[model samples]
Target: MTHEVTDNRQNDSTLASSAFEHQMFKESTATRTSETEMDIRDRLTIKGGHVEGQEQVFTEGAMSLLELLCKQFASQVPQLLSNRVKKQALIDAGELPNFLPQTRAIRDGDWQIRGIPQDLTDRRVEITGPVERKMIINALNANVKVFMADFEDSLAPSWNKVVEGQINLRDAVRGEIEYTSPETGKHYRLNDSPAVLICRVRGLHLLEKHVEFDASSIPASLFDFALYFYNNYRQLLTKGSGPYFYLPKLESHEEARWWAKVFAFVEDRFCLQPGTIKCTCLIETLPAVFEMEEILYELRSNIVALNCGRWDYIFSYIKTLKNHPDRILPDRQAVTMDKSFLSAYSRLLVKTCHKRGALAMGGMAAFIPAKESEMNREVLEKVRRDKELEARNGHDGTWVAHPGLADTAMGIFNEYIGEDHVNQLHITRDVDAPIHARDLLLPCEGERSEAGMRVNIRIALQYIESWINGNGCVPIYGLMEDAATAEISRTSIWQWIKHEQKLSNGALVTNVLFKEMLVEELANVKLEVGAERFTHGSFTQAAVLLEKITTSDELVDFLTLPGYEMLTGQFG
Candidate 1:
C-alpha cells in the first residue's frame, strides 16, 4: 500500500496551536535546535516512504534546505507556468512569438556570459541517461567529456527511483559508487577518469507529489535542485567543479530569470559567490528561441551554454501551433532538424550563444546501435552525418544517448573544433545568414503517411506503458525514446486529428480513424512484445491513456502529466 503523510496529525495541530506544545515534537526532529527543527518540520511534510538510503539523502538538513527552497521560489513557478499559458493563448490567436522588441538592446549590446569552468570548456561529446546506479557508472565511465544525470525526461519519478538517484549521485561524486549484477555477479564501477557530472532537474510545471508544504506539493525543480546541491556542492567544489545543472523545458526569459534567482538564492545560503552555480539551459521550446539573447543575458553570470533540444523543440512547435491550420506538421519521421523551422532555430541558437561567448551545444543523437553489423554501421553513419552538420554549423559539442556513439560524435566535433580550440565561440553567423521570424515558424515540408501515423500510435502506447511502469528511458525501434520523443509522437497525432489531416494514402485523420488505428496498433504492439510480456505490462492502462490524450478535444500539454497521475494513483 502507498503511504502518505496527513496534515491532521494530532501532534501537528497541537504544535501549530502552541509553541510550548511543539517543544516536545521539536526535540524528536533531527538537525539543529528544537525551535528551528519545529519550524522546518511544521511547514514541510515528506509523504514518500523510506527507500534504501533515504535517511542519508533526506536528512533533516536537506529537508530544511528543501523547505527553504519551497518557501522562497515555489510560488514563482505557478506564475511562470501561467505565463506559458498566456503566451500560448496569444500564439493560438495568431500572435506568433517574435524576438522581443524591448530586449533588442540587450541582444544588440556587446556582452558575454561569465567565463566557463575549465572542465566544461571542451564538451565535445556528452552522454546522458537516467540516474540508475549501473547506468550512472557506465555513463560516467563512458568516453565522453560530460554526463548529464537526468532526473527529468529520462527518469521515471517513482519515490524509490528519485531517492536512490540522489544516493547514487552522492556516491558518484565521492568516487564510492558501484554496482554488482545479481545474476552474473559482475561488478561495475567508475573508471579512473570519469566525465564531468551534470544534473538535469524536472521542469517548472512538475510537482513532487510526495512532498507538501502549506498543503500544496512542492515544485519538482526546487525539490531536485535543492537536494542535489545541498548534498554535493561542497564536494563538487573541492573536486574543482561546482553544482553544474541542466535546466529543461523553459519557455521564456522570465523563466530563465526565475532559475537565475534560484541559483542566486542557493549560493547566498551557502555563502558562495554568485557564479559558483553554473548551468546550461535547454532551448527546447518555440518561444525560447525568440528569447535566446534575453535568456543568456538574464543568466549571464551563471550560464555557460545553450543546447538545441531538438525533440522537445519539435513537440513545442506542434504544441505552439496546434490551432494554426496552416502549420499542421507532417509525419514524425518527416519533421527532421533539417526542416526550415528547426534549422532556423538551431542557427539562431548558435548565433545567439556564440555572440554571447557561450557554447552552443547540439541536440541528441538518439539512435541505438543495432545488433546486426550492417545495421549498426548505418546507425553510426547517420549519427556521423548529424554531428557533422552540427559541427560544421558552429555547434561546440553534441549529446549522445549511448556510450557507443560518443567516439563517433567526438571524432566529428574534434574534426570541426581542432585541438587548439576548446569551443566554437569564435564561429559566428551574424554577418552572412540572418534568421528571421518566418524562418523559425515556417511549416515543415513533407507528406503525412498512414504508416507514419501507425508508428506514432505504437511508439506512444509502448512508451507510455513503460513510463507508467516506472521506466522512462526505453529502446523502441532502435532509438532511445524519452519523454520528449514520445511527446512528439503523441502530439503529432493529436494535431493531425485536430486538423483532419490527409495522409499519403488519401485517408482523412479523425477520432474514428485514430481509434481504429489505435486498436490495430495495440495488437501490433502486443505481437511485437510477445504475449507474456504484454500480459504483464501496463499496455491496457497505456492504451486507455494514449486514447485519452491523443483523441481529446484539445491537444494535451504533456502526456506525462496524465501518466504521472497514473503512476501515483493520485488524480486531480
Candidate 2:
C-alpha cells in the first residue's frame, strides 16, 4: 500500500473543473479513473498521487492509452525492481558483473540497430537541459545538433512540470514553442531550423505518483515516454524527423531487454514502423557498464548511440562498490577521465558502439559560463579540454550543459570527424578496450582532503535545497549541478563515512567528525547564499534531508526517492 493524496473529495466533480472546456477530466478521465476493466478489474486501481495544478493534461485519450499500458505492463514493475535486489544480493555474496553468458551469442552475432532518421545521424554536439518552457525553447534554438528535453535528472518531476513539459514538447514538435521571461521580458523561441529533439524519460526505478492502476503507481518512465510519443510522434514524422529518446539509469541487459519490449509495445499500439523510436542508452551504473554491448543488442532495432554519463557513473560506482573496503573512491575531483576505470569505460564505449556501427557519445562538462568574466573564460577553457579528450578518444559527439560550449566541442569533433554529420572514423578498430576487468574496476587511490569532504557536503546540501524547492538544475559555486551530481556528492560522503576514510590532514571520517563538519558547512553555505536566499532556500530542511539519507544504516538506492517523498508529502 502506498500513501495517496486526493483533493476536493467532491462527488461528481471534475479533477480540473473550474471554467475549463467542458471539464475534460470530468467527461473522460473521471469515468475511467475508478472503472473496473476486465483485464485490470481487481488487480489495481488509480487510488492515489493526483497532481493538482495540471490535472487536465490527463485527458480521455492520454489516460485511455495509459490505461491500456497500465493493464498490460504495470504489474511487472515489482518483478523487475525485485530483479535488482536479487542481483545485488548475488553481488553482495561476491559475484561480479561481466558480459552476460546468455547474451554472448547475441554479442558474437553480427547485427546492427535499424537505420535512424537523417537528423539523428550526426549528434556531435547535443545540448541537454530540463523541460522548463524556456529551456525547451532555448535548447532547441541553440546551435547544437540535438536538444534532449530531459524529464529525468535535470527536471524535477513536479506535477506541473511534468504536464507542462508534455505541452511544451508538443509545441516544440509543432514548431510553436516560445517563452517570454516575466522578470527580464526577454523572448525565447526556436530558430528557423532548431536542433533535433530527443526526450529522455525518467529511469525504471521511479514511479509516477499521479497515475496509477492495479494498486501501484504507473512507472514514470512509461508516463513520460507514452505521452510524448502519442502526442508528437506523428508530427515529428511529418517534419522528416521522428521521436528520439535518451534512456537513463539502466542497470542490466535484462532491464534493456524490458525497454526493448516497451518500444515494441508502443510501436505496435501506434501501428508505426518497426523501428520508429530510436534511443541512446546511458551507461552510468556499474552493471550497465558491463552490459553495454548487450543493451545495444537487445534494442538493436532502436538504440542509436551510447553515452558515458560521468556524474551518475561516479554515484553508481561509489554505491555499488561501497561494500568493498579497498575500493573506496578518492575525492570526486581526483577521479579524472585518466583514472583507469573511467578511461577504460570511455574507450570501451567507443569500442563497443563502433564495433556494432553505432555512435559513441561522451560525458558532460558541467561548468557553466553564466556571465562574461575571466573566471568564465577559464571555465570554458576547461570545458574545451574535456571535450577535446573525448574527441581524441574517438567519441562521435559529446554533451554540453550550456549552449556556449557547443561550438568548441563541435569544432574539435569536426576537426577529427570532418564535415560529415556523424563521425565515420572508427579509430579504435585495433584497440580492444578494457581487455581485462581491472581496466574498468581499478581501486582508485589518492590522498583524500578535508577540503574535498567539505565540498561534497556543501554541494549535496545546496543541490537538495533547490531540488526540493522545485529547481533541478542549479548553478552553485560555478557549474550546473543536477540530481546526478548531487547523488555523487552525498553518496561519496556516505561511502567515505562508512569506510572510515582517512583525510590528508590526518583526521578520520567518524560520525562525530562528519556531524561537526556538516554543521560548519551548513553555516558557511548559508553565509555564501546570504540571508534572504538562505531563509527561502530550505537550508534547514536540506541539511536534515541530506543527513537522513546519507547517514542512514543502509545506502539509499536513489536519493530522489526520499527527496521526492519530502516534496510530495506522500510515501508508502
Candidate 3:
C-alpha cells in the first residue's frame, strides 16, 4: 500500500483559525553582524553573530537547503502549533481526547511499515545525551546499540553550541571526531565499531532564533534537520545507513503527515527512495497517545517505531487537563509506569506498533549510578525493574541516560528477547478487552505530600538555572534531569497551586505557600551548592522566573520558551 501525504483534518472544528505568516520575531534578541558567510544569501541570514566555526557549517550549500525547507514547510508549523491550542481549548471546555472516529478505518485496516534498515533492527539499549564532543565520542564507543545525539531536550541551544554540534556530528560520521579536554589533556575518539547514530531535532514550537528567512525566524526542526541531512546523507548512504531521526513532541497524526511530506520532499530532492529517510516518533504528548495507530499509518512509509517519552507524557497530562480539577496529579514520584494511565499508554502503544510490524521502544531510565556501592545497587535495581516491565510488556528496546545503566537495561531485554530475535515483535499483545480511552485516562492514585512539593521546587529551580547557563541535562539528587522531567516538576507545582490541592501535612498548596517553599528551597540549594557557586550562578533569575510561572494566574506553556528568551540575550 502506498501512503500519500494528505491533510485529513481539513474540515475539523479544532483547526487553528489563523494561518502562519512571515514576520520578524519581536522578542528575538539575535543581532545581525557583517561577516563573510553572512553574504551567502540575501533571503537567508544568520543572526547568531560570529562563532569560531560558523563559516565551516554555514556554507552557501547548507544555507540553500535550510532556505528551501523553510520555504516549503515552515509555514505549516504555526498552524499545527495553533491546532494544539485549539485542541487544548476544547479539553479545557469539557471534551477529552478519544480515538478519532473519522480515521477508524485506517486504524482497523491491515497494514505494516514499508521496511526497516539492517542497522536499526536491534535497538535494545540506546543512550541519549547532548551533542557535546566528548559525549559524542564516549556514547558512540559505549556498549549499546544506538547513541541518539540530541539537539533537543538535553542541549542548551547557544549559537556556538548549535553550530559546533553539527561540526562534531559531521566529523563523527566520517570517523574523524576527536576531543582533547582543555583542563585534563585527555583525548577522546570513536571506537572501531561504534553504535548507530541518530539525531533528535528540536520540537515544532521552538524556532532557530539565530537564523532568519524573509526576516522571520525559521523552524529549529527544519534548520537542524536540513543542515544535517544536506551535509551527511551522501556519506551515510555510502556507508549503508540512512538519515535516521527521532521526531519529538508530535501531538497529532496531521503533524506526522507534515513530517512524512518533509521526508518525501528531501528524498525526492536527493533522488533517493521513499523509505530512504526513516524516523521514530516519540508518543510523548497525551493527544499523540490516542492517535498512535493514525500516526503509524500516516508515516508508515518511513516510520520504524514509536517510543514512550514518559516524562513529557506526564507533563502533557497535567497541561492538557489543567482545567479538570478532579484529575490533578499528586507527586511526580507517585506517578509511575505501574499507574493505570501510564500502564494503559504503554500497553496500547506496544499493541499498536507491533500490530503494524514496527518496534515499540520503552521510556528512559534517568538514574545516574551513585558512587557508593549500596546506593549504586539500588539505582541499578530500580532501572532493572523498569526495563523488565517494558521487556515483558513487549517493548523491543529501552533508553538509558548513563553508560553504567546500559548493561542492566541490556540484560533485562536479553532475558526476554534472547539470542534468536532482534526485537520483541513476536509478542503482539492481543487481549480480549482492548485498551480504551478510559483506561488511558484513568486518574492516578497517589498522595500529595509537603516534602514532594518542596522537592519539585528545588529541582525545577536548579534545572532552569543550569539550562540558562548553557547546560540542559543536569544531574541533581542523583538523577539526570532534562527539560522533559524539569517541565513535569514545575508544571506539577503550578497545577497544585492552581487547584489549591491539600498535601498530606494539612497544608494547602496556595500561592502564598508556594512562595514560602520557594524561599526555603533557594536557601537550601544555596547551602548545598556552596556560596561561591551559588552567588555566581544564574540561580537568582531562575528563582524569579520560577516564582512568576508558579504563582501566575495561568500556567506558562513551556519554561524553555521563556528560558530561551533569557538565553538569547546571553548567547556568546
| Root-mean-square deviation per candidate | 9.2, 8.9, 8.3
Question: What number of clashing residue pairs does each candidate have, in the order they appear?
Answer: 0, 4, 0
Q: What's the TM-score of each model vs. the native?
A: 0.93, 0.90, 0.93
lDDT of 3 by residue, 454-555 (tens): 999999999999999999999999999999999999899889888888899899889899999999999999999999999999999999999998888887
- Give lDDT per model, in order: 0.87, 0.79, 0.87
Residue by residue across 47-110, what tens digits does model 2's lDDT show? 4454453444555556666777777776677788898888887876776666677766766776
Candidate 1 worst ten-residue window by lDDT: 1-10
Instruction: List the candidate numbers ranked by lDDT, top first.
Output: 3, 1, 2
C-alpha lDDT (0 to 100) for residue 371 of candidate 3: 99
Off by over 4 Å in 1: 1-41, 570-572
Let me know the TM-score candidate 1 reaches against the reference structure. Answer: 0.93
